[model samples]
Target: MTQTKKNQQPQPAAQPKPGSAFAYAPAPESRSVVDIAPSYGLFIDGEFSDAADGRVFKTVSPSSEEVLSEVAQAGEADVDRAVRAARKAFASWSALPGSERAKYLFRIARIVQERSRELAVLESLDNGKPIRETRDADLPLVAAHFFYYAGWADKLAHAGFGPAPRPLGVAGQVIPWNFPLLMLAWKIAPALATGNTVVLKPAETTPLSALFFADICRQAGLPKGVVNILPGYGDAGAALVAHEGVDKVAFTGSTAVGKQIARTVAGGSKKLTLELGGKGANIVFDDAPIDQAVEGIVNGIFFNQGQVCCAGSRLLVQESVADEVLDALKRRLSTLRVGDPLDKNTDIGAINSAEQLARITALAEAGEAEGAERWSPACELPSAGYWFAPTLFTGVTQAHRVAREEIFGPVLSVLTFRTPAEAVEKANNTPYGLSAGIWTEKGSRILSVANQLRAGVVWANTFNKFDPTSPFGGYKESGFGREGGRHGLEAYLDV
Candidate 1:
């Protein structure tokens, strides 16, 4: 989207009931409505209930800085209760045939399809992602995840994990704010399909979507206590991670936090899977199609406002084609429309929160201070929202903050390399090894680079594309374990 100055504030709006889904389509005039929610409660035992402590936290809309909802602040006690609920349910839930669990996931997937628009609006409002992506990419992939995993439910006998691989009881899942609903499905579908119960903690900033998911679970007639949703900040997540009752811990967030969680749950009886952060590289070779490469580059770093952990933040362009690619990128960037997330025409939406906005702004300044030339498209940011323009830094050195750090905004750092070895070196320079993109015409070059790349996922001539059948996650500091496809089921299985 466009860039806001950081101090802008939008007017307040009315709120909806907590755990209710918001439908913003089929309107007479406008295609969207700004929805707010009141008194969000934790989903425990398949029912919505307030936290025992009565503590709540405001979840603000990044698009307008408006308070969207006040969600339950689940503490250690709440986590324990939820885990107990899950544990109690696991006896029967896990004992049931895998086909039965598949049916539940199938019903949930259908409900997601039926309510996709409502879910998309709420997702956009809460996560500050463009509605186009929320509706098209995030929601569909969420449904697809369940659909893909549902078949595995009945066919687990032949899943190669052996016929008797049982579910790890009471999976404690903590998802990041970037792709809230999608990540929820990524973590939850496999856990449930494999006959495990889930106690999930959605990211603090994007709790609304997960709460909506809980509502979907209720609508789908899922068994009580099979899936619990507790919304709060890092403390709530920490509680879930360290709880003794939890059989496993699965988290998707920054590497810094992943390390802490890894250390906390170390040597414990709990199984853990972490899908952490990344500073991925998108390399453009001289032999690639200039126009297609431009689009790929734009999509690599700018999709979801670059909040993606797999965002191609580092651009390694062949020195010979650098100027041509940069020129096309500027023109391509100009066409991106950053505005109200609900607007069908809007391309870039708001940052997820004020704090994220500050983080992005601080890093942009650091790029400037480091002598990198910053270029932004001509676009008007929202007058009262957390917005940041798609920014690119030229003349970026490997040591530049924008090059090395995860800005988690629509900002890209451009660097040139003369050889494949140099490009590989720059691509692997980061501690995070989540994903990378290679755009070249030569198949041999693509294969060579893909093999040499340290990332878990490498897109050839494409970028940021995902599929339910494809396993995703990272290697090294980006965190361990995969999240989608058959490989993801391994994390929840007691092999």
Candidate 2:
């Protein structure tokens, strides 16, 4: 393992016990003017109610480490109730005229727009994305996703689906923390539009926005029980996927969990879609524009603190242009402002939680110990929050742990290739096949390499671009199924 300067502590269990004082948690703060209700419960049958077991968990803010709210901790019984409600509603909701369904979706989209700032602020607070990206990129795209799929609700007959396409009974969706409300929109809009009801579980670390979404459903006058939001830990998610009443399971998270989900759902009648991890390769050819490529590389890995599943963590530069690209990359990275998510000038935000920060710190240390040269801008990280400066490791070989694993932080690993074939070989070296980027002036080369790549999404000289009209997902261990465009509707449709 490469030893990072930040991770040289003795193992906790190995350390001698020290006389310590009483433990105290951070004090909770007054609620933000954000319209959150006290004592949130599971949304079932279009109503919010306590969990069957009456268990609850505290959701905290990554920025200030403040307790934001207490949310229902769902278990098997709650999962069963949610599934039943969705199953019952699916019949009527799906049976409604397609135009009516489209109208419901359109109403939801308008409501989202009306409360865009609130949703974006809440998302940034809960998930720790920069306020700028959450407001400008994530939330808007989330609303747009609904609008795009809204138009398709009445047009499924014209979609590639065969004649008389039908809705799956009930869909259980599990999304990750990196892109909370956006992921919910990705899952729910398409599912509901195709006429399926949804039992959506947002990541435990970032459930606030989804619960807010449940409120939006009420405001939009969506039929009772058509959409439900459950906030809980992993066991709750497991129960949702294994429930026999659910007609489909759609998930976005790590590959290991995705594999387990696949195993759990195997041989079942329920359909499954997984958008798992990615160690995306951002390649820069010698003839590519150096300044633009540097910007692309920064946006690729540094956006969302590199917590994104589609984050381009690997940089494959042609050997001839490697030095120039690295130089420009360093200069560009130096200028990135990292701090409070609420600050309009902040460039990067906090790591989603203490646990995630620990994982990223451990992996970064391993890279240094394994002989990869690590670098970071001289920017000061905030002391009270979970922060990791955007980082890079040069002289990185494919064998290094940092090169192979998904650090899921703002860390980049740069590797050199002699030719385009070598670039492709190194780019596809990891198990993940989510997304990849190519930077070059040569049009034919872009198409040639893109065709040969195994990833589901390919960006030519662009990074982290999203639109409602484009299908997005991953290949191989990155998980299965698509999330956007017309193709996304397939997951909810019965053959």
RMSD of each: 7.1, 9.1
Score residue 332 of candidate 1 by CA lDDT: 83
- Cα lDDT of model 1 by residue, 130-244, tens digit: 8889889999999999999998998877888987888889999999898999999999999999999999999888888898889889999999999999998899899889888
Q: Write one digit per residue (lDDT tens) for candidate 2, span 1-495.
A: 111112112223323347632322222221243655546889988898999999999988898787777899999999999998888888899899889999999999999999888888788888888888888999899899999999999999999899789998899999999999899999999998999999999999998899999989999999988998989999999999999898899999989999999999998898999999999999999989889889899999999999989999999999998988998899888788787777666789999999999999999999999999999988888778799999999999999999899999999999999989999999988898999999999999999999988899999989999999999998889988898998998888987
TM-scores, each model vs. reference = 0.93, 0.93
Instruction: List the pairs of residues colliding in candidate 2.
Output: 1-370, 2-366, 2-368, 2-369, 2-370, 3-368, 3-369, 4-365
Off by over 4 Å in 2: 1-33
Candidate 1 residue runs with Cα over 4 Å from true position? 1-37
